[model samples]
Target: MQQSNAYIIIFSVILTVVLGLLLSGTSEVLKPIQKKAEELDTKKQILGAVVPAEQISRMKAEEINQFYESRIASKVVNIAGEEVEEQDGVQVTAENIDVAKNYKKAPEDRLYPVFIFHEEGNEEAANAYIFPVYGSGLWDNIWGYLALQTDMATIEGITFSHAGETPGLGARITSPEVQQRYKEKSIYSESGELVSVVMQKGEGKDYSGEPHKVDGLSGATITAEGVNKMLKNYLEHYQSYMERKKEGTPKMALN
Candidate 1:
């Protein structure tokens, strides 16, 4: 009852083609849904920089999108702090720019996205400015959104995420308790020097009296160092834009 070799080969080819087409069709069908989910997650993270974590967690996906659209405006800026209408002929906006991909490029060549948070009805004045930062963690990539008050020096809130890090240790960067510790922290000194906040060597120490210091993770020294470097690096990257804004320069209209 053995089938001929030619019959077996033909049957295998047909099965392979059929399976490939099914997978391709399924992928095409799911692509948009996957993209929407990714977009929603990004919105949630950006909102987390200013909104309370519990509030964000409680909101539905549609509500999150509505809130983001009404309160957030954004623009892309270059390393020199100039508003860029396009990059390499592609019109890039803050929402669409891939911060992780840009992180792979040289600092001077990367496109920086600034998100401006205003009241629901007031777009003329900003309440806070959120900057996205990316860098290495103990095991993989770590990133966050840092929101500054109107003065553009003090942190209003922050939310961190990582690709791969030890749970209960480095991954604690995403904990709301950890992020809240950065609230009201300053990234500049009294003399106007850009001295970004630092996560000291250990945790449980009091940094309340310190403007530019935060308590580090107890057992994740490497991850703490990663966060410190990310904060300082991105703050410096955005320093020129902040200085211009502080100097009464005209702001660009949101895209």
Candidate 2:
């Protein structure tokens, strides 16, 4: 016996709806796990700014959370170096402030998230202040965090992540050797100016002994330029926060 066309159509629709519901239910059930994984990844990236990527690789999720919770303190500040109490009627905090979203807002209105890291036992003396930055690269978006030492002028370290930079070239920004070049670079000049790091072309040497110059990718000039611009743009956004720290202001206290 052959089934009628109408009956076949009805069966097909029922099967499709059942499969769709099953898939949706599975996704819903795994939503919490997915969110936890994302949070772990973010913590890893933030910690990567200061800690070596290899070291971060060895850390467990609990270790990351413990380190971030016990050693690192987060604060939300405005362009004027003032700690924000509330924004749009919601309390301002580091976890809630979206740097990418704030990037699109007006310069003065943007909210900045500053993560201050300290040694395990020393909370009073901050080791570094980490800032997150995002920008367009040669092929896609590039982002990373720059950690400035307590002095607020010298860079302690940095980490870069790109969406689709060419392999072995612009992608090398994430390589240990490339990121190490930024370790001791100073963002401030002798005259106390905000001269963010520069990625020079062709062996990218600081022949002039410039404090803020770093070696750029040999053939990936566009991506290198993107890193340079991204650093400057984000650093300038946090200038007020750094300046306040430099002035020994008591506005930001460790939590």
Candidate 3:
């Protein structure tokens, strides 16, 4: 008792529609959870720029969120360093702006996010400023957060992440050992030029005396170059904001 072609066609259509609806419903159900997870991860990465990785890793997701809410405050700015309250009718926020998408636009057309880490209970007094940077790596995109000390010139801590890169070579950028090398490094020269820190040509060289250079990844020169360019580009983008803050004339208050 074989089914008719019309019956088979009708069954197929019904099956397809049902499957599609099921998938759509499942996606809708999971969307919020996925978003929460991404938000949590982003907070962890931002915190990674200032807090120790081991410390962050030790905490639970709820703890991470609580800590971020209590200590971090953010603002959005443009290339000219003016505070941006809204853009194209949408309220701008440091957490909402996507750095990777902004990287695709012309520098002057992009919005930058500044995450300020304040004292435990005092939001008015900033301890460090964190900025996100994005660039191309050998295989794919690379990005990171750089936290500058209160002076806005010296690096407090740094954290790097990649979309895709060699496991042990270029991927080393995310390693604590590599990032630790950038701590205390200055992004400015003695003459006050914003000569952002450079990842020199090779690893194991003495850059201890060089205020603006760090050891390159062992076998990842291209990735190192990517990191170098990302830092210089984003640092320049944020320079005006830093200068304004340093001179005590920031367009917006820390709170």
lDDT score, candidate 2:
0.86
Model 1 over residues 102-212: C-alpha lDDT tens digits? 999999999999999998868767889999999999999999999998888899999999999899999999999999999999999999899999999888899999999
Off by over 4 Å in 2: 1-12, 204-209, 249-255
**lDDT of every predicted structure (CA atoms):** 0.93, 0.86, 0.93
Error of 3 at 46 (Å): 0.4
Q: Write the per-residue lDDT of candidate 3 for residues 1-255, one digit (tens) a residue.
A: 459998999999999999999999999999999999999999999999999999999999999999999999999999999999999998988999999999999999999999999988788788899999899888999999999998889999999999998999999999999999999999999899999999988789989998899999878999999999999999999999999888873533543
> Which 10 consecutive positions of candidate 3 have the poorest summed lDDT?
246-255
Between candidates 2 and 3, which one is better according to TM-score? 3
Instruction: Flag clash pairs in model 3.
Output: none
Question: RMSD in angstroms, candidate 2?
Answer: 3.3
Error at 203, model 2, angstroms: 3.4
Provide the TM-score for each candidate, comma-separated.
0.91, 0.88, 0.90
Best by TM-score: 1
Clash list (residue pairs), candidate 1: none
**Residue 241 Cα positional deviation in candidate 3, in Å, after optimal superposition:** 0.4
